[model samples]
Target: MLLADGIHAVITDRHGGISAEPYTSRNLGGAVGDDFDAVLRNRHDTAVELGVDPARVVMMRQVHGRDVRFVTEPFGDDPPPLDAIYTTEPGLALNVLVADCAPVLLADPVARVVGAAHSGRPGTQLGVVPALVEAMATRGAEPYQMVALIGPAACGLCYEVPAEMREDVARVVPEAWATTRQGTPAVDIRAAIEAQLHKANITDIRHDARCTIETPDLFSYRRDSRTGRFGGFIWLDGG
Candidate 1:
């Protein structure tokens, strides 16, 4: 959907490609033990479906850190170990692959800057989204003018975590602290991200509330350890 004028965003599910079981169809991640050829094909198909040039799509080798990169073209064979990426060039789509981590898409239509980030428990506590906002600002984007989309991820009720882990993350982002339906410690990564965005002065935020762990149509590492990954894509119109 359109996040703003000229900015397009999409969150894909685990369907429509040509992979086998486990990574069964529409798996866009390349490092999840899926066939490399199938992954390439799935990537191509996803870009085609989005009306974008597959060769221009960029993917990251996410490391659950706050590192961000500015890109103008595809990363090719070896993508860097970064959690966020942005581009000022139109048609150069930025892709974030995730099974349970929140996929974040951001755009400042007035400045023509677009960014995508993989914000999991670690990345969220590390302030990856805030780092992304800072990076985009260097390219003439401002948080007040940016629109953000938090894609499907493991919700708090479904993302039970160890008490210490929850406490650690909550220390960094208190909004992440939560209690699951079963009354166990949990971290609401997406909620934490929203809070971060709000703190950055970004008010036009949107969300795909489907919890990956609860939604069968979506990929979830917490649900199935050996699972495929869906994608969240964002790009500007016109090449």
Candidate 2:
């Protein structure tokens, strides 16, 4: 279990489970064209490893947008199209899949709530982090009391975007240009996420110092073109 000071979570790597190559071992997403059985087994293994009930661990068909799903109760049904999820309920594990896109986990120790955000360019533009924070606040969470951790993702040095894309990012965040490298602009997704967290008054933020595109151990969608998804899961434990 990858335990934070106040929450239970794990940022799963591409090893240790059963999936064929490309997705070669530990692919948790069944909808990513991985075999259903393999995906199920992989998820079960991850849940057990993280100490969450396999039944309470929930994953949605992520649409890469800003839709935030508010979880007030536990259920086995497919969640609505959303890129962010939050819950104050114990034993409810929220899972988000990512390869190069950043997976962000937020927890409020005082409020006893946890949230997960999927921050691709689209999800960032749509303000998924703020949306998750807002949802948590509705469940009696205070933004300033939260601690956020951004898991492994593609770093700014490796992400080269077209000029037009850079301008698009500037519309929301003007400093996005500073994260660029050379003429080809690249956004520091982790930095951008931290900025958003700051804007929401979330002070205690952490980031894994790993870049998927540059690291062989990590699965990168952009690097391989076809790759398996990695998981970032968080849940509140019932004491």
- Candidate number of the best lDDT: 1
Candidate 2: Cα lDDT at 69: 81
Model 1: residue 56 alpha-carbon error in angstroms: 0.3
Q: Write the per-residue lDDT of candidate 1 for residues 1-239, one digit (tens) a residue.
A: 88899999999998899999999889998888999899899999989999999899999999999999999998889998999999999999999999999999999999999999999999999999999999999999989999999999999998999999999999999999999999999999989999999999999999998999999999999999998999999999999
TM-score of 2: 0.93
Candidate 2's residue-wise lDDT over 22-107, tens digit each? 78899887777778899889989888887787888878778888888878655456567878888888888899999999999999
In model 2, which runs have C-alpha deviations exceeding 4 angstroms? 1-6, 73-77, 178-183
- TM-scores, all models, native as reference: 0.99, 0.93
Candidate 1 lDDT score at position 203: 98
Listed per candidate, the RMSD to the true structure in angstroms reads 0.6, 1.8
Q: Candidate 1: RMSD over Cα atoms? A: 0.6
Which stretches in model 1 have alpha-carbon errors above 4 Å?
none
